[model samples]
Target: MTKQEKIDSFDPNGPASGNRIFGLPFSQKDAEIVILPVPWEVTVSYDAGTALGPEAILEASKQVDLYDPFVKDAWKMGIYMAKLDPKVIEKNRKYRDKAVAYLSAVEVGHEDETTDELLAKINKSCKKMVNWVQERTTELMNEGKRVILLGGDHSTPLGYLEALAKEHEFGILQIDAHADLRNAYEGFTYSHASIMFNALKIDNVKKLVQVGIRDYCEEEVEVIEASEGRVKTYFDRDLKHQQYAGATWKQQVDDIISQLPQKVYVSFDIDGLDPKLCPHTGTPVAGGFESEEVMYLFERLSESGKTIIGMDLNEVAPGPHDEWDANVGARLLYRMANLFGKNAGVVG
Candidate 1:
């Protein structure tokens, strides 16, 4: 069926059908927004299952209702995820084993050529994954589709940012629990902890506005300070203090939004939400916004009329037995994608 034919016959209230994302029957060629799932987590440094995030979110996304209150009948906009690349997954598992072994040796104060070899392999493979993501992202962008990345870790979006930087000068609105500002964290060039540090290196990325940052080291703090206002942080503690002092959430969110430029990229790490909401995430932080609070923030962002250049959601590691994390990730992904669509004028 043609796009319109499928939409005309589809029932928003029915169960998801046809195996497509959110059960929408749209192919890559037909979609206005394309989701690229990156199944790589070689530099997690802590928990490991974030490599499973994309597929887990895909499975749990079947539970998301088609209707988004923020954008009426938004499912018609043709949202789709390309098939997860098997080669990427295979490489991730291979390098992740090396990372684990290397980190274990480092923990014991054992440094050897073998450990160095493992570290070298992991870093090279990680760079390959980033390049892989960048190539695909550029291809999709050339097709006139808005790309939304579903990531294995915060590090995964660096490639997406690279692709965008070539053509657009934009600021980042980063919703993350940590600053991710470590330079070559843990000696891994593309560590998840070093994502923002890598991102700022891109000349087209003019600024970074970070929110929900409740976790960071002195190194990251120093990075932010050295940025000389290029990097703005709204710590979770400070936001809480503002509320304790009788300021409204709207007022705080407005200030956060003000830090951004007219064109923006949204990078949401699941741990940015309360740990209870993303307990299985790679590195769960203690404090975060309620689901509704963040959702409301996204709503206000769309209202602000900043052109959403791209988006990414990452760090949603699902537990072995509990689907709660993926379930939450799926719904949030849906809402966030809709917000992007609404701003891009692809969804009403």
Candidate 2:
């Protein structure tokens, strides 16, 4: 059926019937937005389930209600996820075991030749994944599709950033609990913890504005200090302190957006949210924003007149029995996707 015909027959309030995202009926060609699901997670330092995130989120997305009060008729902004790459999946499963063994060895100071070999192999594959993402996204961009990357882990977006840097000089608005700035963290160049550090190497990326950073090491702080205003940090503690001093979130959000350039890329890690909302994420922190608070940030961002060049939502891991994490991820993705439409003047 054509997109209009599908729209005519579908019920927004009924049980989800198809495998399509949010039960929307548009195919990739019919939709204005495309979601690239990266299904590889090799260097997760704490948890192992995030490699399964794209499929989990895809399953959960079917159950989400399509109505949005903020972005009316946003369901018409079609979301089509590309087929998950099997090569990436195979490599993830193969390397994750080695990553686990290597991490365990590091914890006990038992690094050996085997661990070194594993590190080299994993790093090489991660580099390949990055290049794959850049190439695929470059093709999608060439087709005039607005792409949002749904990730295997935080490490998935380096190539997406590389693709964007070729044509646009944009700032990053990173929402996460960790600083993600450790250089070659744990000897893995593409470790999830090192995404932002590696991102800074891209000269076209002019600024990075980070928020909700409650957990980070001194080396990350040193990186920020050495960045010479290229990095702007809004620590979770300082934001709370300001709130306690009677500053409203609206005021704080304005301050945060002020640091960004005209063009922005949103990099959202589900762990940036309170752990209760995303308990199965790779690394859960003690304090973070509620879902609505983060949504409000996105909402305000849409109203700020800044162009959203691209976005990625990462680190959503599904539990064995509980669907709460993916459920939340699905709803968040729905909201975030609509805002993408709103920013681009294509929907809402």
Candidate 3:
């Protein structure tokens, strides 16, 4: 069968018939883009639904239109899905239960006899999860595959970032509502809020360009300001001011692009979108960018000659009824494909 026909037969939202070709596949050697589903949401502070995020996104991805209008023929890039780690899921469940029990006890002004033990257990689980993800991501990078992590929460990408750092000295283009610059949050060393702090310590990360930062602790703000030029924040309020001052978003986007290094790693938190799109995300803030605005920002970055080395889309939690979060995530995945297609040197 022709290649286009194979791709056309596979609807991203529809059930995949055995013969239909879904997303991009790697070449004869192996898949070009390796998708690592890290089904972990243990350290999420405010919400509990992100553990199912990866599967929900994959299920919804089945319905995405494969023909990317931007770069064209992005499906040919050979996207390969890795096996979901059920062991990770099991560990995550245990951690979450422990955390919930501990938090519940604390909230009610009661002390559980096993409080200390449970907290210790949860921290251990988070460390193990990070090591596992780091191991998997490192293996894939050694194999010359660009990794796109399907996350359980924003914390899930820390290991991937660590792995990517080993090979590429790149800047982090962080798109998120929160600063994620806390040293450790809620007594968990690997909490979602600490990802950037961990990433900042990694030697290979050259710069951090954080966008959509509307929520952060005062200390976190001080850290960003004190970092000199190493950590640049285009705070959401500043973005609004730019628009209010008659700066077109296109120009602002270009300005955003200028702060980035030639090579970038996009850490996209779904909560960076307007909360309306992802109500279930762990800590949806009061204000953020529209999905299209974020997409355009990245698209402009791609067009301005920056290479997206690796990326992670995280914090997308599915609600009980609507699939809005996954839908947004799947489309973002397509946009990632378009960016990767442009950068990976794929021909249309």
Q: What is the lDDT of residue 230 in candidate 2?
A: 99
lDDT of 2 by residue, 124-195 (tens): 988999999999999998988899999889999999999999999999999999999999998999999999
Candidates 1 and 2 compared: the better one by TM-score is 1
TM-score for every candidate vs. truth? 0.98, 0.97, 0.91
Report the CA-based lDDT of candidate 2 relative to the real structure: 0.91
State which candidate has the highest TM-score. 1
The lowest-lDDT stretch of 10 consecutive residues in candidate 2 is 16-25
User: Candidate 1's residue-wise lDDT over 1-348, tens digit each?
Assistant: 899997898888999866678888888988889999998899997788998999999989898998887798888998999899999999998889888889889999998998898888899999999999999999999999999999899999999999999999999999989999998988899999999999999999999999999999999999899999999999999999999999999999898898899999999998999999999999988999899998888889988978899999999999989999999999998898888889989889
Best by lDDT: 1
Better of 1 and 3 by lDDT: 1
Deviating ranges (above 4 Å) for candidate 1: none
Report every candidate's CA lDDT.
0.92, 0.91, 0.81
Off by over 4 Å in 2: none
Give the CA lDDT, 0 to 100, for residue 19 in model 3: 20
Q: Can you give the lDDT of residue 175 in candidate 1?
A: 92
